[model samples]
Target: MESPNNKRKRVKPILRCSTNEQSERSPDDQLAIIKAMADARDWEVLDPIRLEGRSGSLHATMDWAVEQVIAANRAGEDIDDAIVYDQSRMGRTGGFAFGTHKQQLAAAGIGFISVDCPIEGPHADFIQFANAEAARAQAISIAASSARSSQISLERGLRGHSTQAPYGLDRLYLNAQGEELFIIRKLADGTSLRLDPRTGAELERYPKGVRAYRKGGLETATLCIGSEEHRQVVIRIYRLRHEHGWRGVRIARELNDAGIPSPRGRHWTKDTVDGILMNEVYLGFAYARRYTDAIYFRHQDKAPERLEGPGGRKVRGYRPREDWFRVEYPKLTEYLPSKLRDAAARWQAAYWDRYEDGHVRSPERGQKRLHALSGILIEETTGQPMSATQSGTRANPKTYYLLPGSHQYSSQESFLRRRIPSAPLYRAIIDEIEMLVCDDDGLRDILRTEILKAEAERRAGDGEAESLRARYEKLGRKMESQIDLLGEDDDDVMRRKVEQTKAQRRAVMERLAEIDQGPRLTADQTDELVEQLIEALQSELAAFAAAGRPAFRKLTEMLIASAVADLRSGTVSIEFAVPASMIQHRFMGMDRPCEPKWRTHTHKWKSLPLAAITVELPERCDMDCWEPFEPKGCDDCRRQRRTA
Candidate 1:
C-alpha cells in the first residue's frame, strides 16, 4: 500500500477574468492550463472555481473560492494546495493584500501556488511582492490612460464616452467626415428608436428592455432634440414648474395619471422628475467632470499626497462648478426656449426659499396615522395604487386615499373625481364584509366555486410542469456533454456555446423549482379548506364591533388581497387574500397565501354629494364653496395668496 504522505497532493484551482475584453484570456483557458500543470506535477485537481467580470483588486471577489479551500483543509479533507493560473489573478492590490491572502492560506495549512510565476526558497517572498507591485502599477496606468482619453474627447467638443442619453434627448452618431450616420432615440418607455440620420425617418423601433446600438470605431456622438412627443412632455414639465409652481412629486403624479411612461419604463418618481428639472442639458449646456473621483482606488487609500481639497474631507465628491466642462449644443436650445428655462430657474430658487422659510412641507412629514388600505387600494383606470394624503391642521386632520394626480381635481363637483375619504371608505368596506358573513349559504357557494376553479387550473398546469421537468433534464445533459467536449485547444466559439448551454440550464432549473413549490391539493382537501376559512372569518366577524383600528387593519391585511376603485362606474371591486382552496394549506404551513385567481366581487358605496360639504375660505375669496374654483384661480385670488 502507498504511504499517505507519498500520495498525490489534492489541489483546488482558481481561475478569474476581470473583463469580457476579447484580448483577455478566458477563465476556461486559464482552468485548462492550470489543470495541465497539475497533471504534469502528478497533483489531484479538484473542481476548479471560476470568476468572470470581477475585478482582481477586490479581495472580497475571491473570498468564495478561498473559503472553500480553507474549509476543506479544516474538515480533514486535506486540500494540500490552493493554485491559481497567475499571481495577478490572486489580487492586483500591491504586496500587502496579496501577502495577507497568502498568509491566510498558510495559516489554514494550505500552500499557495501560482502556475505562471512559481517561486520557492528564500527569495520567494521578494519575488511574489515584485510581481504584485507590477500588477498594481498596470492597474493604475490603465485607469490614468482612460481618464486622459475622456478629457481629450471633452476638449475636442465631443460628448465624451457616455452612451446613455438623458430624457428628451437623442444621441446622433457622426462618421469621421462629420456626416450623420444614425440617431439613437432612447425613450422614457425603455424602448429605442433608430432614425435615418439625414431625413430623421424612423428606421426601426426596438422593443422595451432592448439595449440601444453602441457607437462604433471612427464614430462620434452628440446630443440632439428627441421625439416631438418627448419634447412636448419636457416643455410641459417646465411649464408646470414655472407657471403652476408644482413640486416634483406632484408633477410625477400628473405624468403617471396621464399614462406617460417615465424614464427606465417605470412609474414616475420624485427623484427622476427632480433630476430632469435640475439637468442643464435641456438648457443647451452639457456638463461633465461635475464630480470628483473620491471613490477611485487612488483616493480610497486616504494617502495625504493623493487627497484633494482642504481638511481631507471629500465634500461628498462634488467638484467646483467652475471646474466642470461645459459645452453648449445649439440643437438642444430649440427643445426648450430661453424664456421658459430662465423662468424655471427662478421658480426653483423661489421654491427653495419657501421651503427654508417653512411655508412648504413634504406630504409625508410629521404624519403618523396608519392607513388600513394604503397598499391594497388601486385606481382602476390607471391600475396604480392609491396613496394616502392628509389636509387640514395636525389637531383636526382629514385623511383621504386617492390617485396621486387626482389632487388637481379636488374642486370638481363629482365625488369620484376627487379624493375618497378614508373613514367613510373603511366603514363601507366593513359593512360589505358583515353582509357576506351574515349570509352563510351565499358565502359557502362562492367558496365552493372558487375552490373548484383552482383545482381545474392546477390540473391543467400538470402537463406543463411535466414538460418543463423533461426539458430541464435535457438541458442538463446538453450542458454536461458540451463541458466534456472542452479541451486545451478548444476555440472561443466552443467555449461560448458551453456558456450558453449553462445559462439555458439555469433558466430551466428555475422554472422547475417554481412549479414544484406551488401548493398542491385534491377535491377532498378543497372542501375542508373552504369550511375552515368560513369558520375563521366568522370568528373574526364576531369580534369586529369591538375590534380596535389596529385589530381591524390586521384582519383586512389577512383577509383582503386588493381593492380596485372604478371612478367612472362608481364601484369598488375587492379580491380576498386567502382563496378557499389555499386557506387550509396556508393555515397549516403558516405560509402567506397567493392572490385569488377568480374574478373579484364589485360593491357600490353611497357617494357623499359635493354640495353637502361646506368650505371656509379667506375673506378675499368670493367663492362660496371649493367646487367653482378653477385649478388656477382668478388674478385677485393669486395676488392675495402671494401677498399672504
Candidate 2:
C-alpha cells in the first residue's frame, strides 16, 4: 500500500430526479454534472447513487452515502466528503429534519459539497437568506405537483379510462370509433407496455409510460358497464345486510358457501364484504384522487417531513371527503333495478349501534348469572367483589359466589361459603330497595325534594345573570378593541392588557353558563319524570326483572353505593349513595372557620349517610306474626299452635 499520508480522497455523488420532473431532467443528466465537478478537482469519485425521489428530511438522501463515508474513513480509505447537486434538495421539511441530518453527519466526521449552496457555517449567515428562497420554491413546487396530480386523475376519470373500474361495473375498452381494444397481458416484442390497473386498458411503459392508444373519428377511450352477475350480487348483498338484517361476516360466509369467487379469486372475507358495502360506485358515484401522497405519509401523532413508510414504500392513507373529485353516473340504476340505498343506510346504522353498545361476553352455561346479584357481591375480608365459581360438572352444575379470604388464597378454615342462593339474594336486595322507595319517609321522598328544589332554582332565573351577560359582552368587545389597538408601539403592554381582559371575560362566561341553562324545563315535564322514576323503583318484581343487567348496575351504584360481607361477624355492611341532611344541618352558618381547626368544611361524601354494616337477612324471613320466637314464645297461643 502507498504511505498512509499519500492516499487520494474519495468523493461520491448523490443524484436524484423526482418522478414529477424525471422526464425534464433525467438521473443521467444529474450524474453527468456531478462527474464534471469531480473531474475539475481530480478527486477519485465513486459510482453515483440514484435515489429517484426517495423520502425523508432533505438530509435523508445523504444517509446511505454518509454510512459509506464513515466506513471508508475507518478502514484507512480516504473518503471524507459527499457531493450533491443542490443543498436545498436535501430536504423541504424545514429546519428540524435537516438540522438532525447535519448533526448526524458532523458526528460521523463527514462533510458535504453542495454544488449550489457553496457557502455555509457560522461566517455564512447570509446563506440562510438564500435557503429561505429555496424553501419557498419547494413549497410552491409541492403545491403545484398536488394540483397537477388532481388534474390528471380528474381527466382520466371523466375520459372513461378503465384502469380499475369499481365493483358492480366492468371496464370495456374501446377505440374512438367504438371498436374495442384488446389488453395484451404479455409483451410480444422488444417494447414496454402494461395494462392500467384501474381501467384494464393496455398502455405503454412501466410506471411512467405514455399510452400509444389513439382514437379516431368519433371514438372515445373506454366505457364502464354493469357486469350482470356482479350487479345482482351487489344488490343481494345490500338486501341481506339491510332488509334481512345480516352481519358483514355472515354475508361473506353466504357468498363463499354459494361458491361465488371474489374479484381477487380468493375466499370471501368480512373486510371484503365491508368494502363492497361501503363502495359508493354501486350508488352511481365515482370518486377520484381520494388518496394522495400527503395521506400516504400522514400519521396521527405528527406530519412527517418525508413521504415514506416503515416498509420503504408509500402507505395509502384515508383522505378527507372534500379533497375527492366526485362525479355521478346515474346509469347504475339500469343494472340494480331495485335500489336498496335505504337498506344500505340502515345496515350501516345498525353496525354502528352494535359497535357502540358493546356486547356482553357470555360465561360458560353453568357460570352465567341468571340472578342479578351475581357480580356486585363483595367480600369484606379481601375488600374485593365475590366471584361466581362452579363446584359441579357441566351435567349437574352448582354456582356460588364465594369469598376465599384475604388475597383469595383459598384458606379452608377462613373462607366464607354462600349463605344464600343467587335467586334469594336478588329477592332480598329488591325487597330492600322497594321499602326504601315506596315508604313516604324513604329515599324516594328525599330525592323528589332535591329534584323540585333544583327545578325551582332553575326556573327563578338569577337576578344578577343579565348584568353578568352585559359585562361578558362588554369585556368581549373591549378585548377586540384592545387586539385592534395592538401595534408596534408598546406591544408588551398591549399583550398584558389583552391577557388580563381575556381572564376577566372567561370568568364572566363561566358564571353565565352556570346560570343560563337555556329555556327552563317545563313544570309538567319535570313532574312527570320525577313520578316515572319513583314508579320505576316500586315497579312490580316483573318490571324490575325486565331491567337489563347494565341498567340494574347503574341504579344500584346510584343508590346503594357499595355492599360488603364479613364472614366472621356474619354481617353485611351497606353504604348509600343518597345524602343525609342530618349531618349537613350541623354545618349551617359555619362556611368559614372562626379559628382554623374549629370550623369544618363538608365534602359530598360526608353529607351522604354514614356507611352502615348490619347482618343481612332475607326479607321474607323477618318475624311473621305466625312464627314463634324463643324469647317471646309466640304473639298468640293460636299463632304458636299454627306454626307448631
Candidate 3:
C-alpha cells in the first residue's frame, strides 16, 4: 500500500581511502556522512562496501565493488542506485574509467550518485566529467609535488623520504642540531628494533602495527654500519670477492652451506650476493634521483601523447647518470676501509672482463641445436652441470658436453678434462632405454616397484601438505589483519610488509595446489595404466625413431632426470626422470605426475668404453699428470707464481 513517490530507493554506499592520502576522510567518516545523506533523502542504504588502503587511481581495486552491485541489481535484488561519498572516491582515472563505470551501472538499470557532487537534470553528465578531470589533475599535481620534495631532500644530503637502509646497515636519525638520536634496525619479522647509539642499549621494539615507526618532526636520517655480527659477515664477503676472486654464485653457495642467513633471512642466491657487491652504499656513497616515473606508448612508431591519471601504462625508467645526486658519507669508511674499497673496485672490473670473454667465446653461443641432457649432465669431479658445446669447423661440427671453467683455463689444460662426446653417450643411454621399454616383463616389474615407492612417498607428503595448508591459512589471516590496520598516513615500509606477506601467502597457496593435483593412483588403476602406457609407448617410440634427433631429444628429456660422468674413471651414472607408474599415468592423457626420488644406477657400457668416451690424441704428450685443471697452472706452479 506504498505510494511510488514516497517509496525509499534501495542503494549500496561505497567508501574508499588510499594510504598516500594524509588528509583524506577515513572510510568510517565517509560512511557516517553517506548514511546521514541517505536518511535525509529517505533512501534505504545497505551495508557499505569499504575499500581501505587501496589506490583510487587503479580501476582494478574498485572493479570488485562495482561488479557486486551490478550483479545484485541484475539478480532481482532491487538495487535502484549505487552511491559514493564522492566521484573521486569511485576513481581518479579521469573520464575513461570513471565514465565507463558510470555507463556500465546505468546499463544494469542502477543509477550512479556521488553524494558530495550531486548533479541532477540535463547537465549532470557534463558536471560529472568536469569533476573527474579535476580529480585527475589533482593526482598529477600531488605526484609532481612529491617528486620536488624528494629532490630537495636528496640535494640537502638528508635521506630521501621512505628510503630503507641497505643490508648490513641501519638508519640513524639525527636531530635538527645534527646530534644522533637513535638507530633503527629492521628485523626479519618485519618489525624494527631501536637502539641507543652511545651505549648500544635497546630503546624499544616497534611492532608491525598501523605505522612502521613513529617519525619525529624536523629529523634527518643517514646510514650507519649495523651490529657487529653483520659487520663481520660484510667484511668476509668483501674479502672473499676481492682477495680470493670468488664469483657471486660461489659466494652464495658458500654462505648457504655455512647456514648463514641472507639479508631477508632466506637462502642466499647469486643475485642477492651480487646486489650486495654492486651496491655503492658500502663504499660511503648514497645516490638519489636514480629513476623516474614514465608512461610508454604501446606503439613505438607513434608519437607519445600526454595521458593524465594513473590509468596509462606506467613504467619506471632509469635517469641519466649525470642527473643523479650523490651524497658522501665519510663515516662509512670506518666500516669499509680505503684499501678494501679499492680492492673491491679492482675485483669488479676483473669479474666483468671474465664474464664478457666467456659470453663471446661460448661454444653454443648462437646455435639452436638441441642437447638432450643439457641441464642434467653433471661432471662428477666438480658436481657442476656440463654445458653443451660445439667445436671443430661449421662444416664438420663436433658436439660435446663440457664442464664449465674451460674458458678460464688454456686449451691444452681443458682438452679432455671433464668432457664427454654427445654422440657416444646419447647412443648408449637411448639403447638402454629402448631395451627396457621393449621387454614387457621388465616394464611390468619396474611399474610394480615404482607404484609401491610412489604410494609410500604420497603418504609421507600428506603430513607436509597439511602443514602447508595450516601455514597458508595463518598467512591469509595475517594479511587481512595488516590490511585492516593500515592507516591513511602509513608509509612505504608498512605497505611493503603487506605486499611481502601477500607474496608469501601466494607461494604457499601454489605449493598446496600442486600437492592437491598430484596423482594418487591405486593398485588396480596402476595395472590398467601400465597396460595403456605399454601400448602407447610402442607406437610412440616408432614415430619418435622415424622423426629423427628432435624427437629423440624429446624422448630423452622425458625419460632421464640426470646423469653424472667421471670422464677420467670411464664411468657413467644415470637417474631416471620419473617412476614407471607416473610415466604410465602421463602417457594416458592426464596431467604430468610429480617427479619421484630417482635412484642413480651406474653403468659401464661395453659398446662405448673409456677409450671411446675420452678424447684421444694421435700422438703422445709429455704432460700426463692427473691434477685438477687450474686456470693459471697446476697447484705447484700456481703457488710459486708471482703477481705484479
- TM-score for each predicted model, relative to the true structure: 0.40, 0.33, 0.41
Candidate 1 clash pair list: none
**Residue ranges of candidate 3 with Cα displaced over 4 Å:** 1-86, 104-124, 160-162, 188-193, 204-219, 227-277, 294-315, 334-644
Worst 10 residues of 2 by lDDT: 598-607
Candidate 1: residue 175 Cα off by (Å): 4.0
Could you tell me the lDDT of residue 437 within candidate 3? 57
lDDT of 3 by residue, 196-270 (tens): 988879888866433435445467788888987887888888889887989777787778677788887876667
Candidate 3 lDDT trough over 10 residues, lowest sum: 599-608
lDDT value, residue 532 of candidate 2: 54
Given candidate 1, what's the lDDT at residue 29?
Answer: 80
* Global lDDT of model 2: 0.50
Model 1, residue 593: what's the lDDT?
47
Off by over 4 Å in 1: 1-91, 101-128, 160-163, 185-195, 199-220, 227-271, 294-316, 336-340, 347-644
| Rank by lDDT (best first) | 3, 1, 2
For candidate 1, write residues 400-437 as lDDT tens digits: 67776453332232344446656555655555565565
Instruction: State, as a TM-score between 0 and 1, how close model 2 is to the true structure.
Output: 0.33
